[model samples]
Target: MTSPLLTRHGAVAGLGPDAGVPWHYGDPTAEQRALEQGRAVADQSHLGVVTVTGPDRLTWLDSLCTQQVAGLAPGESAELMILSPQGRIEHVAGLVDDGATAWLLTESAPALATFLDRMRFMLRVEVHDATEDWAAIGEAVSRPAADGEPVTWVDPWPGVTAGGTSYAADPTALATTVRPWRLVLVPRASLGAEIEARLESGWTLAGTWATEALRIAAHRPRAAFDVDDHSLPHELDWLRTAVHLHKGCYRGQETVAKVHNVGRPPRRLTMLHLDGSGHSLPEPGATVLGRDDAEVGRVTSVARHHELGPIALAILKRSVDPSTELTVPTDGGPVAAAQELIVNADGFSADRPPKPGPTMKGLLMGKGCAADGGDLPG
Candidate 1:
């Protein structure tokens, strides 16, 4: 499944899920600058595509996902998550509907499609893994489809959609974080040609390195990097786009409701500004240590930004103070880090209702990830 675009001069293959795609095309810093300036296109053909059709597609999805999708309009896009019964995130996708078909762009398409297929007992929905037929490309903004009419899923990150609330310590962060992201679907067969055309038109080609850098800087979460068996929406600040507060009962609605209404997430997502004086960057799953030299969290993703130098996203125990300076063990030694809070220690809705009786707060704070399964993906 290696991308044909990888044939481009200077293309270097990525690893893991990003395998078969370009990690960078010689110069990542310049590529990142072009991408942020909206003059670059990044290859994202490794992403999975799932198509759901039939008259009941929207309602069936709405009943199962965290987002309210039943009334999704023709060109509207939204993010959704499928959670385990305990409210742990299992799958996440960007959803968009054409007049007749619903397209899901995800990192876990096979699993998502299989889950959707099994859920269709008597429902009229038909789910198909269209990953082989379609490929995706990332852009700073939506562009005209080449070859045919392509579906685009616009990212709604860092935005509080209707029935959603924020847990960010700085409310202005949501208003100020600007990532005009879009994923455009194209015929898989023509992807190389399409990119060549864009290149001819003066658009620089970026890679996963640039995209990951931008995503980390924006405090955005990716399923392949951020999620684990115990990942809760509140922990990642994902409720802003993925969960509908007032949606009808979905698989994990009860836990979702309880956490936001009366309890806080045991773990919080944070941004780490790493010491850039050294050449070493911490790898994903690197241990994050507090001043006491004790493990407090794990780095989920890491990237060296064009301007921000070394930065990473980590999930820490909610008790970790925002002012605490931390360190991450890397191959080149320990790198000093400073925390920028993505989700606060009080990882609950700002508009949570006052409730009486014992809350789940004590239970969650005491157990942490061990209560859900010892380890949450770093």
Candidate 2:
């Protein structure tokens, strides 16, 4: 269940889903600094691990999710999503293939495994919830694999991978891209001993609070914190990594194509610079209000960065003006917030052309072109 290290010096347990792990050590600021400097390792054992085996694994996965993985090379890391028929994200995972097995590091392991198993029809694929056998450790920089050459999933966030498009107006300018992060799967049985060894070797032990602060600063989104039932990749600007516009048919391809070509996401993700003068931070799900105190959005993730003071990621209606100063209702009162655009106000990919006139089938069949402003990018 939980990391043995949770009992060690200065450890404080996390809340909700993070209850099984450490929230922080005594000095959260120092822990955050150490993590950023790469002198610390975070125990993320609470994350789930799933395994898929058999010859048809890659191709089968390619047919199901949002990313193109049929040709995924061994050790090459990827981020993928399983979307509903309406193109709403249902599950998200960090994937890495080890030639013989596809290891998925996910926040929703049992549900993901169950869905994949139901889709396996006559295919040779086998899905297993390997959480009992494996656990994850977080690192800021990629490290050499230990003795087993454990599957490591390098995060490809904020990068426009092949066949994917970016919604961020300035993808290269994102602060998130510079901070490299990855998850290393380790044998669960020896996890505590392994962490102890790293500590003995001079690595400082940080916790979720440290890691989360860096994430908020970088504008990185986690499914657990960021996603809602109605979330779309476009809203979160997830198209930069998760969705492949040119990939073969998948469950939600129609909706995805329609949105990118003819529609805009109803909402957009925004980073809020909050007034840190207050003693406490607004909790997740706190209502975000615009001019006249109108409800405009909901706060998704909140953190106090070592340098940035108080910051949060919120999903706001696309119609909300990016220049508008907002407020979040906290126990003390309302805290003022300034918006830092994460997804463009227009809520579409940067490179996508003007709206097309043709039906979904016509666009898929390559019918309409110049009428939509220009040919769609491959």
Candidate 3:
């Protein structure tokens, strides 16, 4: 009933963050509190922020990433993804420009570095693992950035202060009252001091779970659970923003054009309302089933939302049917499942992250591990 990798203030991290909170790797309480009261902060020092500089930076990055980066006017940020030759996502990052350099922020894990190396083939670009140099934080507000800038993080379930107000004369003044700003901090050693400073400065720090659920609910895709080499960029609904259809060719360009113009992927990411009955709610990787225990999908995350009871982010194949009443096999028995999706007023499906990896079976399936009381590797 606890997340093995999550932490609350890093206190019970390796020790577990207690039972009430759901750990997707961070303190679920932080997230829960954030959703309930509109605020919380997370320990994002574990993510790497790669800075790309030089005159050739824009052209080099434009040729490598799926997002358009040639005209970034410093002080602008965009979520981006780098795809593999096969059209799978190699690395997905928040691409922010400070008017001088480009910053690619991703999980501190080596996967993104591996991606950067593969992407630096013939380009005159430099990629540095600034993980030890910066940290990131997100805040949701009831209004738009007071200075007139686009909110970097979009509220998935509504209630965002959305509007273009890039009117701030300075960065500090801009961030102070911004509607939704994912502030990135630098230097791993500076994370604690930075967070403390935010708290002292009266910034609302929501719990990690609340943040995760809000992003999931908002249909906003993010790292860890979202990017993998097998899934295409379009699958996560990053078409115009992350994946520019008119952009120059990148590693996955050929297949991307082919798929977008020709095929529809078999599965789609969805949100679900869970009954949370038998046993504790299933964590990520549990399989969802239709009638007769038919395989339909797998959950990416599950959190007890302050308002929505138990909710989940899942990937279900199209044949599974969005409205079908289903059950998901879990540690205990089966928990009831119902499919849901987020659609904006513009009729565009909001961003939703699919499972990072493809897995047809449970983590310990047929390994005799679970039966032997073995812990599963996520």
Candidate 4:
């Protein structure tokens, strides 16, 4: 899965599963700046690509995911979540229909294909793992698309789409407003040349860290980092784009409706401005503590931005006050964090109080009885 550009650029490769990709070409800060300024390209070929063929593709996928895709138009972008029967997120993908096939961009392609294969029972759709055949290249919209590249999925983060809602109380903090992003799929063989050409044109090659930092700043929740086996769409503010509240029935629809209508999500997603004076970052799974030193949540993602020093995304108890100063347990003991609300503290429910029942005295008066029956005789 390693890209040819990795060696050409003398990248300081990451270890283990990230062996093939560059953690940074040389300067991570400069790379991040390039990305923020729209002068960089990120090799996202590590991501998985799946393609669904046949006429029933859209309808079949729509029935299995949270988003409505049956009527998707060519080149239009949408994201969906495959939830378990209990309404927990199991899989998520960015989708685009090319008039003939439905392309899916996911973090785990083989697993998605396997899951879809199990559901194909007599369906006309054919799911193929195109990971080996394709590569994903990402850059900000300010970096124009490569000419003749036919398919690109523009990110819809921090934006309120139709049938969606925004949970962010402050619009200025949204990332997309600062720099829009897009992911383009290219043939694996051509990926190297494409990257080289961009490099030749003076564009810097950024690593995944740069993109992740920007994503965290935007309050964007990613499936790989933010989701667990029991993550609900409401908890991550994914209802803003990934879930269509009025969409036709699908797996986990009941749980989605129940949580959004009458009940509040047990946890809420929040952005934390970490106190970076410690010069240490809290690793994922670091316990987040309330003012009372009670474990309220865990940090899901953390990053140091070129401007924002250090930041993190955490899922805290819905009752945790947004104004409360919290702390995250780090190797250096603990780090102070200030909360910037992502999901509302009230948990986004619209339930109302029950109507008051008629008082006994009013009922008796309406029945022509005073204070009590036969009160006049008494």
Candidate 5:
């Protein structure tokens, strides 16, 4: 069954009971439309964005995070990570500063706390679980960011939005930290009326399954599902920007540096354009095979592409060679697929050959940033 988290704001349009876990009935057509033109809104309240502060904030944060956090000015945003002792990712999140306070957003607040607790035992910082204290709404629109109060612009990654509406606690008076921009929205229920009145229009509610599909089509990775205990930053192409190799030690710095310098990870994630064969939905753990019908990898996440038929993400052995065409390893037979360079999958800076050659990914692909969808912010 889909947890309350997945189905909370989402639903199955034609059916009474919505899609099951993994949200199989994800709205591909609607998702693609949201990307291409106009806008589509999604609920992101399940993820928690907590605040960490105190005199030790800067030093403590720098020690706990994968990206350097020592010099962030108030009202600035940067993307960073937390790693397991083995160098695999725990969560890659955004760090928001309002000068006095710093916030971190991740899929699980409890999980995040556990990671932070290890470092906070002796540090003078306090970690607050502020997920319930706030609500989030995600928008993928071609329009520009809101125009009003000072906006906290965070360009942590290539296509992500930092703080469309960042809120912080007030020490003296009632001051709100919010903005109108391209991003996942987190509206405070305490001030729900004020927020609702602020944006009377231009918001759409997303069900769990639909939201998952939209993200997969964009070739984006969510914390737990897209990432796992074993994933390295490079597997998801989240290096340099998210993980700082030159920075001092963190839980998994040595492993990160070793992999980066060695130029290898067991698996390489890529996008696949499949036929959507027999209406067959390949769930995660389903096998991926090569053109010669040999096992290559497995599907991680899938959503029907708005314009490109069936699309999916898979991690295959890096040694498989670019010349090897891939197919779905299934009972019926190998499902034919074409290698699709995800619009966001940037070629390796160290190993990749020059481009204007092998297609540019992420927003720079097909029609540029507007190809897979639009110039919208998410």
Candidate 6:
């Protein structure tokens, strides 16, 4: 469904495989600037919205996803991931619960709806593909709408919530404070008017490029761009907010525990600060090379930020040194890149052994040995 605002802004239409939406209006650089400054609105109508209704909605969803959603309050925002039985990410969604319904915002509404349908064998919940009836409008804001109000999902990125863990060693380095974002759901029919109102109130209309650039800079992963069939929450640092380590058993919970406790994820996600002097950017799927010129990983997302120049998120082998200089395959041979760690090279140390405590005999021993060469008294 092409946005009605497309006609007003002369937007060049780009039909996504899942939905038709604007790629950009005319100037993406200015759009990106506006977004970073919190003076822009994005037509995110292309995203899928699914509604789950029934008295058992929250509990039913909580039992299946990675996040703790059974106690989700009305108008509270949270994100969840549906993993395969083997612990690979299969789907993800941003969730918001109204008093009566739970709204799910995802990249592919149809696929999520179908999957949920299959899981609802004798459940009391009813899932509906609300994409046609509802649309998402994005804004760079500090918070979501007030509680018990309009449907909205405030992004919980770069923050370590309760029952979650952070892979980033330095919490102060998080960009959430600098680049906050929120998504508001409105009736599809009123989307054009809503855009007009925001425009009339001095807000610029941004495109997907602007939003994606900010997303990459903030190290936030998107399901469509960042995830693959083999992706796990720990690999992308998604356990920071999306997964509850102590949550009740859900699909893939066993693997989540095992990888986090006894093993490390095979791959780790890292941010690459690219050398932009070449006037070119490496596309997604570009080969990432280690210091020895061996393939270590592949670029999953890349963007040219308004302030940060060219940057990308890549998934590299766990053994790849964070201090090592890397190269990305580009049309001009290769581009030099430096890694800013997202996931630590050692991965989560959940299963590390406790430090040995001093025994009672050792505590009682003095620093000086006995003068007669006798053993220290216990």
Candidate 1: pairs in clash: 300-378
Instruction: Tell me, by lDDT, which candidate is best.
Output: 1
* lDDT accuracy of residue 151 in candidate 2: 79
Candidate 6: list runs displaced more than 4 Å.
14-19, 147-149, 175-177, 349-378
TM-score of 5: 0.71
**Candidate RMSDs in order:** 3.8, 4.2, 11.9, 8.9, 12.1, 8.9
Error of 5 at 110 (Å): 0.5
TM-score of 3: 0.72
Q: List the residue pairs that clash in candidate 2.
A: none
TM-score against native, each model: 0.93, 0.92, 0.72, 0.88, 0.71, 0.89
The numbered model that scores best in TM-score is: 1
Q: Write the per-residue lDDT of candidate 2 for residues 1-378, one digit (tens) a residue.
A: 778878998999988667789999898999999999888989999999989999999999999999999999888888999999888889999899999999999999999999999999999999999999999988887543444677788888767788888777556668444566888888999888878888899999888888888887777788999999989888888888888899999998887887787666788888999999988789999999999999999999998889989999999988899899999999998899999888888666887766545565354424243122233433
Give the range where candidate 6 is weakest over 10 consecutive residues by summed lDDT: 369-378
Which whole-number lDDT from 0 to 100 does residue 354 have in model 6? 38
lDDT value, candidate 3, whole model: 0.55
Task: State the weakest 10-residue window (summed lDDT) of model 5.
Answer: 165-174
lDDT of 6 by residue, 164-256 (tens): 877664556785347788889999999989888999999999988788889888889888878888898988989877999888999998878
Cα lDDT of model 5 by residue, 1-378, tens digit: 222334334444321222322232255466545534435444445556677878888888888778877887766667788888877787777776666777776666677876776678777888887766755444543332343422233434333222111111111111221112234334455334433443467543434455555555545555655676678776666663576666778888776654444224556667777777567667666788885677877788776655567778887655466556777855655577776543223223343223332443332333322111222122
Candidate 4, which segments miss by more than 4 Å at Cα? 8-10, 15-19, 142-147, 171-176, 349-378
Residue 176 accuracy (lDDT) in model 3: 31
Q: Go through the candidates in order and give each one's C-alpha lDDT.
A: 0.88, 0.85, 0.55, 0.80, 0.56, 0.83
Question: Number of backbone collisions per candidate, in order?
Answer: 1, 0, 24, 0, 13, 0
lDDT of 1 by residue, 179-264 (tens): 78899888999998888888899999999999999999999999999898889998888988999999899998887877776567
The ten-residue window of minimal lDDT in model 3 covers 160-169
